[model samples]
Target: MHVLILGGTTEGRLLAGLLDGTVRVTSSLAGRVAAPRLPAGEVRIGGFGGPEGLAAWVRRHDVDAVIDATHPFAERISFNAARAAATAHVPLLVLRRPGWVPVAGDRWHEVGSLEEAAAALDGLGDRVFLTSGRLGLAAFADRPEWFLVRSVDAPDAPMPARSELLLDRGPFTLDGERGLLARHRIDVLVTKDSGGAATAPKLTAAREAAVPVVVVRRPPVPQGVPVASTPEEAAAWARALAG
Candidate 1:
């Protein structure tokens, strides 16, 4: 059985590693990331040229099944993958980690998109800690009075009016994030609902500091697709389907 994994998240890598050698697995990565920790399997970087290209690849590669283990905010790719898989008549599975739930004292202001979050930032705070990734920075480009943008890689394009970019990886501690927040005097936090332990410390720090957060809610999942919460579950499902 041949399997293609639309991957970039930790869960995707873990799933690919688990399925290594058991099936002919190929992991597809969006090349936007710099220095990505790749999985143990055949790796293909960059986009598949949208739904048509992806469908063609599926047919050409003889992909029997596809596992979408991308980030929850990656809705476009997820939709394209679903369309492509359907076109190619291959089974599809989505591995999405559960979203973060607001705890007590968490000053959460959920928004549908980054533009809404940008509009909400007018009276909220002066200094902002943006963790909404690189692709959507244009939404805040015009409103960038001040911002401290953090990303795994420097944005491919230019940023907003006045902004400082911090190129780093996370799994940051609450104490560290709190210290940074204090030093920067950040009053507002902006992030996507990328629920995981690695980047979750910022939310805790924001809650402790009473800083209001503008969280971009996860994009809606494609209708009628099988979903799994963990790499193991996705792998098991793929194996069963292959059998």
Candidate 2:
């Protein structure tokens, strides 16, 4: 069976690795990052021109099934993948990691968008640790705040007035995150609910430092798609369908 893995997350990479020897797997990356860690399979980077393009590619490649293991907050592409899979008349599965839930001792201000996050920063802090990724920095541009924006890639124009860019990858440790927060004197953290342990240490650090976190809620996944939370489960589902 041939599988198209729409991958840009840890789970996607893991699924590709798991199915590499078992099936003919082709992994597609969005190419948002300049230096993305590649999975162990045939990899294609960049967009497929939305749903129609993806559907065309699927038909051309004779893909039997598709697994969408994109970032939890990557709502647009997820929806496109669903529509594309439907258009191609193939089975589709979504492998989305669960969102983080605020617990006791956490100071979380949940917002629906980056604009709300920017607005929420008014009385929170002057120094901000912006972890909402590179795309949405424009929303925070007008806020009179000093931001330490961290992302794998540098963001574009219309950024915050007083901000320093920290180009780094994650899987950060609590010690490292704590130090960063302390050294920068970060009073507030702006982040998305892009869950998984890989980047959860920041939340711990924020809790420990008594820092208020402005979390942008994740957008809803596309409806009526089979969902898996782990690589193992996704592989099992694919195998069943392949059989």
Candidate 3:
């Protein structure tokens, strides 16, 4: 049986590794990220054209199952995967890591999108620490406000007025982030609910400094799909389908 994994996150890579050699597996990456960690399996980079393209690929590749393991905030790709799997009459499973929970000391103000977060910035702070990735920087471009944007790669589009780009990867230490917050005089932080330990230290730093954070809530999961939180559970589901 051949299984296709819609992958771009750590959970996706781990799932691919867990299923290595167990079944004929292929992993698809969006190719937007630079220097992505390769999973253990056949790997294909770039878009599958959209729903129709993905559907054709599923049929042509004789795929037996699919796992939607993209980032939680990757709503469009998840929708396309759901549509393609249904069109091909193939079983699909979604692997999503649980979101982070707020602790007492954390001052989190949840928003729906980048624009909303920008709108909420008025009362918060002038110096903003932005960790919302590189794609959606345009929403904040009109703000003309001061910001310290950090990303793995340099942002493609022009940034907001008076903004400084910091090229860095996360799994950053609390002390490091604290120094950044302090040195930049950042009083507010903005981030997506892309939950995981790797980029979570900033939240802790914000908490320490009593800085308010504007967290973009995660996009809703596609409805009526089998879901698993870990590679072991996903493997079990795949094995059941194989049987």
Q: What RMSD does each model have against the real structure?
A: 1.3, 0.8, 1.2
In model 2, which range of ten residues has the least summed lDDT? 218-227
Q: In model 3, how large is the Cα lDDT of residue 239?
A: 81
TM-score ranking from best candidate downward: 2, 3, 1
Q: What are the models' TM-scores?
A: 0.96, 0.98, 0.96
RMSD of 2: 0.8
lDDT of 2 by residue, 95-194 (tens): 9888999999999999999999999998999999999999978898889889999998888988899999999897899899999999999999999999
Whichever of 1 and 2 has more lDDT, that candidate is: 2
Better of 1 and 2 by TM-score: 2
Instruction: Report, for every candidate in turn, its global Cα lDDT versus the true structure.
Output: 0.92, 0.93, 0.91
Q: Please give the range of 10 consecutive residues that has the lowest summed lDDT in model 1.
A: 153-162
* Per-residue lDDT of model 3, residues 28-143, tens digit only: 99998889889999999999899999999999999999999999899999999999999999999999888889999999999999899889888888889999999898888888
Among these predicted structures, which one has the highest lDDT?
Answer: 2
Against the true structure, candidate 1 reaches a TM-score of 0.96
How many steric overlaps does candidate 3 have? 0
